[model samples]
Target: MSYSWSTEEYSNHYSTDFDTIEECIKEAKDMGCKAGTTIWIGKVEEVDIRRVNLTSILEDLHNAVYDDVGEFAEDWYIEDIDSKEAYEKCENAINDLVVKYIEENGMKPTFAKVVDAELYVIK
Candidate 1:
């Protein structure tokens, strides 16, 4: 796998992919990255999209439902609803919401996971 390098002074900047860490280090020095500057080396890996966590969404929905219904009943509380059923019902809605949001506004900013990552200080 190709390797790339970045430093604290240029966190947003990465060197071109090289066959070796030794090449990355040489390029970092050539670019005048100072001694003691922290450097990171790694290969970029794609982020996997998976199911979204629904607990927080369920809790929020529960609180909202509780707030509206509790106004008319003294005994109403958040735990009156079954969480598993609630989660099951809202799963598609939440997923659809996320998909809609991504379609309208584009996917949220994501960073690649650096595999076989290493850190060093400029010498």
Candidate 2:
């Protein structure tokens, strides 16, 4: 893995990669940054990318629909009580929905997966 550092004052520019965190910090101090100056250190690592399926996307939409409609029901009589089942029906029509979305938006839906990294601060 390679590591680099960036300071708040020069956030747009990141330092060149160093093999060790100690080398990164030494370079930062040599550059005249004071003791209290805030800096961010980042390390690059290889991550795996996986394809997401239509069923997973539809399930997320189903959960959102339930949160918006079912969760707020005030009484026995609620509006759009069948909204949750709409997702089940969507499994059959998902292809049509995707085609329509591509036709109207000129692009397919996209999703991203984020990986969290631990931050180490040097005083």
Best by lDDT: 1
User: What residue pairs are clashing in model 1?
Assistant: none
Off by over 4 Å in 2: 45-122
Residue 2's lDDT in candidate 2: 70
Error of 2 at 104 (Å): 39
lDDT string, candidate 2, 1-118, tens digits: 6767777433546677678777878888888877766666666443322333445774566677777898653343322335667645664476666667665886643422222223
What are the lDDT figures for the candidates, one per model? 0.71, 0.59
63: Cα error in model 1, Å: 0.6
Give the runs in model 1 whose Cα sits over 4 Å from its true position: 7-23, 33-38, 47-51, 71-100, 108-110, 119-123
Model 1 lDDT tens row, 17-121:
788888888898888888877788888665644366676655676677768887564444443456777766676677777767875897854555556668978
lDDT of 2: 0.59
